[model samples]
Target: MAKYLVEASYLSKGINGLMKEGGTRRREAVDELFASLGGRVEAFYFVLGDRDVIVIGELPDNTSAAALALKVNASGVTTCKTTVLLTPQEIDNAVMKSGTYRPPGFDEPYEVENWEGEGGHLAED
Candidate 1:
């Protein structure tokens, strides 16, 4: 499963709704949303800032996360921003992967021309 950082900002109407239902109920509703999507809500917070809520959760994949965000956004109550979070191990693994990508109209791999390499000059230009 992939983790996500969900930043949600409630509109005026949503804030009024929250005032009526209360924070605990709002959090419970979020939990139910996550449960219905085959995921779990790790943390849900209502804070004072540009964003009203911050949620950390894990879903099966990016598609699942997007689906949840879109559904909530369509409701017109809150605007959500979903960010995919990567683990340290995932970053380490990615750093070790093969790199064969090249810029357009280029032949060899791209690298700093004047930057010194570990052992010394590593540029071919």
Candidate 2:
């Protein structure tokens, strides 16, 4: 399963619903929604900021995550931002792979190297 961080800001209608249904109900609703997609919520919180709610959860894959985001955005009650979370081991595995990319206006592709180094800073060439 892949993990995700979902930040949501409630619209006026959503806030009104929350006021009527209460926080617990809202969390339960989120649980149900995630269950329907074969995912589970790891954490849920309401905070004062640009976003009203934050959720950490896991889904089967990126497609499942995207589906959840699309459904929530379509509800018209809230806007959501979804981020794919990677583990330390995943990053290590990625760093071991080799790849190359050409910069804009450049003719040759530069070899990409593992950037991990002391103090977590990129290694000097």
Candidate 3:
């Protein structure tokens, strides 16, 4: 299972619904939605500021997460931003792997005479 952090902002219609249905009802509805997708909600909170709600949960995979975002956004009630969560072990595993990558301008000639550009110069070994 993949964990996700979902931040949502409710639109006018969604706010109206929330006002009528209340917070617990909305959370229950969200829990039901996740269950239907074979996922589970770990935490849900109503917050202030830019986002109206925050949800932390685990879904089957990225596809399931995208599907949830698409369906909710399509409803015009709320807009969702989903972020995939990675554990510390996952980061450690990733760092253990090796890869060769050449950034742009890597092999290009640098005008040392006019090296007044940003980022300074590369040190010589």
Candidate 4:
């Protein structure tokens, strides 16, 4: 299974619905949605930011992730961004590989930061 980070921002209609149903009910609804898709919701958080909610879960693959995103987006309630999440071992494997290719005009100072993998946070690119 692949993990995904789904950042969801509620549209006005969705927010109105959420306001009536409240957080717990909203979370349960999401859980049901994932379950229907044969996925499990690992974590769900309602936060004040550019995104209204952040969800982390494991799905079968990228297709499952994209399908979930498109279905939710089509609902006219929320827009979502889905990103694949990699574990530390996965990153270490990537870092071990040799690469020399850089994007066009990609000269810039790189900043190094450590990720603790707390909540749904993944390593930054």
Candidate 5:
């Protein structure tokens, strides 16, 4: 199982429906959805931001995550973004494996003074 960070923002229609049904109904709805995907929602929250809901869960795979996202998007009442989470050790291992690529472009030190003015380098043009 893999962990995912799922953020969702409800459309007006969905919010209205949720308001009508209340919290327990909302949890049940989410639980059913997760169960259908062979996953479990570890935590969920209603938040204020670009997204209305934040869900942390363990999912079977990327395909399962995409399927869940597609279903929510298809509902026409919410939009979602799913991020696959990685542990620090995973990142360290990735960094160890990234030695093949060579850096590109001018190797001179980047100029901080050149950026002091608004649209700085372009202004000289």
Candidate 6:
């Protein structure tokens, strides 16, 4: 299973519905949704400011995560963004792989790793 971070903000219609049903109902609805997907909701909170809800959960894969986002967005009452979470060990594994790449307009010349060159002659505009 993979972890995901969900940030959702309720629109006016959703807010009105929330006010009528209260927050506990909203949490229950989320729990039910995850349960139906064979997943689990780890943490859920109704917060202030730009986002109304923050959810942490795990699903089988990225497809499941995307499905969750699409379903929430189709509701028309709320907007959601789903982020794929990575652990520290995953990042370490990623850093071990070698790849070729260039930055910006450095098609002329550039070096990403260790280099021996004149101090002021390194970068160009």
- lDDT for each residue of candidate 5 in 36-69, tens digit (9 for 90 to 100): 9999999988888788888898899999999999
TM-score of 6: 0.83
lDDT of 2 by residue, 16-52 (tens): 9999999999999999999999999999999998999
Give the per-residue lDDT of model 4 (tens digit) for 1-125: 89999999999999999999999999999898888788999999998979999999989888888889989999999999999999999999997876554334546433233333455333446
> If ranked by lDDT, best first, what sequence of candidates would result?
2, 1, 3, 6, 4, 5
With a 3 Å backbone cut-off (N, CA, C), the pairs that clash in candidate 3 are none
Which candidate leads in TM-score?
2
Model 2 misplacement above 4 A? 105-107, 112-125
lDDT of 6 by residue, 1-125 (tens): 89999999999999999999999999999988877777889999988888999999988888888889999999999999999899999999996877765656567545544344556344554
* Residue pairs whose backbone atoms clash in candidate 2: none
lDDT of each: 0.89, 0.91, 0.88, 0.86, 0.81, 0.86
lDDT of 3 at 45: 99
TM-score of each: 0.84, 0.86, 0.85, 0.76, 0.77, 0.83
How much is the lDDT of residue 3 in candidate 1?
95
Segments in model 1 whose C-alpha atoms lie over 4 Å from true places: 103-107, 111-125
- Per-residue lDDT tens digits of candidate 1, residues 24-51? 9999999999888889999999989889
Clashes of each: 0, 0, 0, 0, 0, 0
Candidate 5 whole-model C-alpha lDDT, 0 to 1: 0.81
